[model samples]
Structures are given as C-alpha cells and as structure tokens.
Target chain A: AQSVTQLDSQVPVFEEAPVELRCNYSSSVSVYLFWYVQYPNQGLQLLLKYLSGSTLVKGINGFEAEFNKSQTSFHLRKPSVHISDTAEYFCAVSVPTGTASKLTFGTGTRLQVTL
Target chain B: EPEVTQTPSHQVTQMGQEVILRCVPISNHLYFYWYRQILGQKVEFLVSFYNNEISEKSEIFDDQFSVERPDGSNFTLKIRSTKLEDSAMYFCASSEAVRSYEQYFGPGTRLTVT
Candidate 1:
C-alpha cells in the first residue's frame, strides 16, 4: 500500500512570488506520482505526473514538480504565481499494476495567492 | 478531446433512500473509476471497473455500493441505502487502458443526504 503526506495544509503567497508545496510518500516499491489542481467546486484537473525517466516534470500554468526518490518526495513549485493560481493542490501516488491502478492522495495544500 | 461526463450535478435525498450516479467515459477509454470527497477531505477511491466487472475496490465500497456498466457507453454507481456520511462530491473518472495513471475526471455529482 502507498500513502501520501502533504506537510502544509495551507500556503499564502503574494502575487509574482515563488512558492513550493511539499509532498512526501511511503512505499516499498516503485510508484507513479502526480499533482492535480481543483478550482472552487470544479473537478480535479491534472497538473503534472511522473511515471518514469526524468525526475523534473513541467505542467500547465507554469507549474512544475521534482520527484526525489531518495527522499520519498515529489514537491511542486512555481517560479511565480498569480491570483488565478489560488486553489487546492493534491499530490497522489499509485503503484504499477496490470489492471486499473488506484491512487493514494494527500490531504491537500490550499494555495492562497494575494495581491 | 474526449472527457468524462457525469449527470445530475447535484441531488438531495433523505436517509435510507436509494441514489444512482451516472457517468460517460471517454470514447476509447477502457478503465473507469469512482471517487468521493467529503468537505475538507482528500478524495477517496471507491472502486475501479474493467471488462464489465469490478477490478478493485476500497473498504468504503461495501455491499450497499455497487457499480455497473449497464450499457456499452454508460457506467453507474448505486447506493442501496444512503447515510448522512454519504453526502459528498462523487467524481467519475476514466483513462485509456494503455495509460491508466492519467485518468480524466468529471465535474462530479454532489450527493446531499438529509
């Protein structure tokens, strides 16, 4: 079984400032990592994912994340943020399987961007 | 681009009432999933379906909860007897069989139990 832990429950950043939302996981085997964003009451939108190869993954809205296997972390970062970027971000992980894979999600980090 | 779609964006029912949420997955996708999120909580997986049957399910998907692909194009989740704790936003998702990790999610159905 896999589990995700997002250390920060909330993060407040000023406009155009850089921010990082930390995420850590525990798994005995290899796993896939992902980041999803939800705005208001809308559905979850995939921001980025790391399946294999590169540890650094880029996503929409200038967001990116680095998968650090040694530390069991996949932290999401953005050089600059906007008011529109304010939303809830979720970090998830799934073990490889032949059939459908199930995800373990973190508690989520609410990014509140202010002027 | 293909996307998952769900019906009855919101529904309200009394306890012990039955409720069914519907979903239409992407045209060529072969995997389907159901997840729910209570207020201020992370999304919880309910079940995953493939080949006309359930492939995996979490403890939350008890006997009262069942999923079916009644038709080639539609998938549904039925709760036999609703409970107050069942009130949440239920999301339907799907992904291509080749890449099951990148699932596309629907807007979700908000189930309100009173």
Candidate 2:
C-alpha cells in the first residue's frame, strides 16, 4: 500500500515571506504527486501535479514542488506568500492499479499567513 | 470552465436514517469518484466509477454504501442506515480519462449524522 506523510501539521509565516510545506511518500512503484489547497469551508483546489518529466513542477498561484526520487519527497514551496495563501494544504500520491488509479493523501498542513 | 457540482451543501440527518448524496460530474468526463474527509483527518477515497460500473473501492466503502449514475449527467451515493461515524464532507470528482490524473472536485456536501 502507498501512503503520504506531511511532516508538519501547521506552518506559520508572515506576508511576503517564503514558505515550504514538507511532504514524503512511500511507494514501491512510480507514482504521481500532487498538492491541493482547501480554503475555509471550500473544496480542494489543485495547486500542482507531478506526473512525469521535470523534477521541478510549477503550479497555479506561483507555487512549485520538487519531486525527489531518492528521498521520496514532494515538498511545496513559494518564494513569497500572501495572506490569501492561508489554507489547509494536502499532499497526495496516485498509484496505478491495473487500469484504474487511486490517490492516497497526507494528513494535511495548515498554512497560516499573518500580516 | 466546466467543473463537478454537488447538491445539498449541508445535510443534517438522524442516525440510522438513509441519506443520498448527489453529484453532477463534468459533461465529458468518463471517470467519477467519491471521497470523504472526516473532521481533522485526511481525505479517504470511497469508490471509483467508470463505464457504468465500479472499478475500484476502498475498505471504507462497505455494504451499506452504494453509488449510481442513474442518468447521463447525475451520479449519486446512497448510504443505508447511516451511522454517526459517517459524518464528514463527501466530495464528488471527475476526470477526463482514467490516466489523466487531473480529477476535478466539487464543492462537497457536508453530511452531519446526528
């Protein structure tokens, strides 16, 4: 079975400051990685996804994540953040099972951006 | 941009009562899925539907749970004899294809089994 681990439960940062949300996964086979953000009382919005090719994948809202094969990590990062960036972020891994695919998600990290 | 949509943003139901959740996936998408997120917990997959049948399901999806695409546009999930533990946010998602890996999610229906 595949699983995702988000090391931090919460991360606090000031506006315009850089932020990094850590994520790690364990899977025997190649997997697809993704980051999703959920604002207050809203459904998840896809931030980025890593399917193949480049290790550095850029996503919406100026966010990016690097897929480190050796470390089995796909950490989300932003050079600077805004108050609007405050939300619960989830890291997920999708593994192919026969003809279908399923996503295994992390516990989620709440990003609290302060002024 | 077309996106998945679910009805009944919030539902409060008594335990042991039956509740049905509805979803309208993207018109052209071929795959549909249901996932749930209990308060303060990670999102868990319930089941996946394709070709008018269930392709896969998690252990969390048991006998009491069922899914159907009764029409060309609407998909539904029925929980028989709902339990208190079933309280959570149920999300409906759809993807253009199975391998696309880009499953768009709906706003979700918050089911509160009291």
User: Each prediction's DockQ?
Assistant: 0.82, 0.67
Tell me the TM-score of model 2: 0.98
Candidate 1's C-alpha runs over 4 A off are none
TM-score of predicted structure 1 = 0.98
| Candidate 2 residue pairs that clash | none
Instruction: Report residue B96 deviation for candidate 1 (angstroms).
Output: 0.3
> On residues B30-89, what C-alpha lDDT tens digit does candidate 1 reach at each position?
999999999989999999999998999999999999999998899999998999999999
Candidate 2, TM-score of its B chain: 0.97
The superposed Cα distance between candidate 2 and the true structure at residue A1, in angstroms, equals 0.8
The worst-scoring run of ten residues by lDDT in candidate 1 chain A lies at: A95-104
Residue A14 lDDT, candidate 1, scale 0-100:
100
lDDT for each of the candidates?
Answer: 0.95, 0.93
Give the number of the best model, judged by lDDT: 1
Candidate 1 local lDDT, residue B52: 93
Candidate 2 runs further than 4 Å off: none
Task: Spell out the clash pairs found in candidate 1.
Answer: none
Name the top DockQ candidate: 1
